[model samples]
Target: MKLKKIGNVEANYSFWQVLVVCSGQEFLDSGEDLIASFEINSPDVRLVLCLTDDLLAARELLKSLAQKLIALSMYELELDGDVDDNQRALPYQIARNVLLQTRLPTLLLESCSFVRRDITLLPAELQKADCALKLRFNRKGISQKVLTNTLWLLPNSRVDRFLAQAISGMAKTTSENEERKAVYKALQACRGFLKVAALPGRYADRSHKHEGFIWVRLPKEKAETTAAREFREKTRARFARPPEVIILHPKQDLGTKSHLENNTFKRRVERLARPGRIAWRQMARLLVELSWERGKPARLVPLPQWKITKEALKNYEFAKTIFVPHLISAQLPHPKAYYYMQELVPMLFTVDRNGWGGVDSI
Candidate 1:
């Protein structure tokens, strides 16, 4: 049977809308340093994979995510013309048949619009297969609870098959222990909020360049008093690099919804929690500030959106300052926005230190 097209245009719009909605909602606000740290430590999570004919849809989703999410990218996989030839099939097809089927389908039920619509139409065998597979996979050497937690929601469908196969491929390339350890180590680094490189772009051929900045998370209650100073000193002693460690906490304000009536404000807040500054920008701002506070003459170039000026750049270098790039409004490609900031902050910091002053702004 020929697989039906879900209208790439429609699918793309649908996917884009999903991304925007998810991004706007408080999806990852629980101070999950794991996600942020893993992105910095592992490349796989950084790149997003899409398997559809809708290139426009894929692009839209990728661009939007690069702008909003911490670290993300999009890739399009092409299934071969030969329907029965499994070797030539696309990764997404495998994902559909495998990952989305088994317990993984449950995730779709929770978050994915596409998967939810199709779950009701899948067969019993596929569902059963998915559940069994998840049960077995979770028991395997891969001990990470996060991956298992995500897979427990798979639906019984061809989608499950595809995901299973894709995951298998990932498994073969890297052991589960390796992945889990990597995640743990990265989180350890980020918990105290160190500056790191940005995530790689997900598209198959995009240049993996550092884009911007992000402030990593720290362990809870460690930044309140003398503990904060000790933490900073420990960082200074360990890396010989005392970074500008910023402790971030959520704050409620009436800036965006203040103009509305009380009821409307309440509704908006209820619908979705307000988003904080992306981690990368927060890191960059800190890097600039710390360089100045330390009496290190540096060049600071604030990206255009951040609003640092060219004169500000000159000021940083002339008087124990840090010059950041001036903020520009050009739209960035996929994954660069959040991922690159990790690398970008340090690069800018290095530049400021080397007396490379008075360059381009924003």
Candidate 2:
């Protein structure tokens, strides 16, 4: 897999600088008999393997096919990986652990429903995973000490089978070693974005142990404690662990599960969802308005409560809660012009753009 530049070919934001990808292999065994497994060797790390749901049906079909091949003096058996690699299938081991363990059930509960005072629906079966490993897409890039803080956010249900097929195609051509390396790189990059942290400078020989931080964002409109973030914070507050937030967007009403429509719709929505950007613009404006009301050029200003615009209410189904932290930084050069630009959520620990690096300590 290679990290490719995607979205907004002419966009100027620093966040849009990179995107990484890896081939997903499950598509090759789609609709066929397959078994996925995961191994929980460490209490800190849990690896999961997913397999085809039609394992029984594939077994039956294979039996009949095998008999016909045997009569032709060409006995054959379909196998997942090479005999050597099969002996070390991590996903298969992980799958078995998931089936036999009670912890999986507990974990599944969190993923069952997207619940909130305002946002009622969310994605299901989202998993939280953490791992520390050396990652690199190309030799030229630095391999800093890397950590993976992962949550399987909402699925693009529309791209289900087509995504599977795409993965299968990639798997057929790419070497397993190369694929693994590529996936590790992509995951590391994703984690860095969510945490507002830096990537590793180099690969470490020892297995990097990562930590999992999962929960929904706190809705600003509702009472703050009822938010998903509060629950996670309560659990790990004593340890002062770093936070990772994943915002999921679930499928609204489409019926088809194949990737074709999902990808098509995803592309269409990305174009139409300029509201997300617009919302930020409004936030920036609100901050400026508040600053002016204070009668000073303040370094920070609170974003005023947003009014639900009629145009936005017509298209979006879910209620959005715009959160403005105590600090605000206008990316625009002139403080006066900052009011016109879009505003991003301030980092948890950052007072402003200059102190963003200090966020982890808080």
Best by TM-score: 1
TM-score of 2: 0.19
Cα-based TM-score, every candidate: 0.21, 0.19
What's the lDDT of the predicted structure labeled candidate 2?
A: 0.24
Candidate 1 residue-wise lDDT at 144: 45
**Pick by lDDT: which candidate is best?**
1
- The TM-score of candidate 1 is 0.21
Prediction RMSDs, each to the true structure:
20.8, 21.0
Model 1, 195-239: lDDT tens per residue? 222121121101111221112222244342464334333322322
